[model samples]
Target: MSIDRRRFLCRGAALSAGLLLAPGWRAWAQSAPMLDPAARQARAVRYVEQASAAQDDPAYRAGRRCANCDFFSAGQRCSLFPEHRVSPDGWCMSWTSE
Candidate 1:
């Protein structure tokens, strides 16, 4: 007699293939080890702004682009730097403003 498909595929239920075969239950499991909640990489931005007011300052230079910054995303928008224009002259803790 043929068996019902639904009954044949019950999760965690053991099914025997034939004589001499050990019954093995079918189940899904995650491949990766679970991570501890306390241990994780977290990115946070404090702030970003332009020093244009001191344009003549000795420290102010044009080569300080955000693209070269560690925090600046390739798209040019900074997470903490709200400057919409996101000028290359901008500076922030999240400044990748290369």
Candidate 2:
């Protein structure tokens, strides 16, 4: 029957609610893994197609992949985009490719 009054009250209520929710945003902020950035970066596959020529190259053919590596975040796919996401067929120097 009276739309103007209800609309004004609703807007005021929403504004107050949003203002109250603002300070609480910190609680919703995503927490990082326990591992440091260096450790996280280690999982990011940067070099995939080549092998190191060093006398003792750590890169191997088996058990080495972006998915199997510890550096790879659990439930996470590729370390490259972290979002584009890829499979373990994946390999890279960053491959922790465990």
Candidate 3:
């Protein structure tokens, strides 16, 4: 059996659209491994799992946290740390308001 080019292209486009529109697909794609505070990247950003724990640092502000940062997304993902997720309550020197 042989398939026509037009039919094949249409099917491929449909499949691609279906996957993009599927529920939870975005969440699954965004989810990444949790960030380790002791990792080199985390250290460079001074990331702390608990915002309050960063109180000793001059950059620490009273209510700043990952959950409220511009770089944070669903599933604790942080754009600054692409490979890992940061705690919602985490604080980092790179944090920016949403």
lDDT tens readout by residue for model 2, 39-66? 4453453434223322143655555655
Tell me the alpha-carbon RMSD of every candidate: 18.3, 12.1, 6.7
Which parts of model 3 have CA positions greater than 4 angstroms off? 1-31
Model 1 stretches with alpha carbons more than 4 Å out: 1-55, 82-85, 88-98
Residue range 1-98, candidate 1, lDDT tens digits: 98788777753255334322432211111222322212222113222345343345454455554556665543344444323334344543433432
| Model 1: pairs clashing at backbone N, Cα or C within 3 Å | 48-92, 65-97, 65-98, 66-96, 66-97, 66-98, 67-97, 67-98, 68-98, 69-96
Whole-model Cα lDDT of every candidate shown, in order: 0.39, 0.49, 0.89
Off by over 4 Å in 2: 1-58, 74-76
lDDT of 3 by residue, 1-98 (tens): 89999999999999999987776756664566789999998999999999999999999899999999999987778899878888999999998984
* Candidate with maximal lDDT: 3
Write the number of the candidate with greater TM-score, choosing between 1 and 2: 2
Model number with the top TM-score: 3
Taking all chains together, the TM-score of candidate 3 against the true structure is 0.72
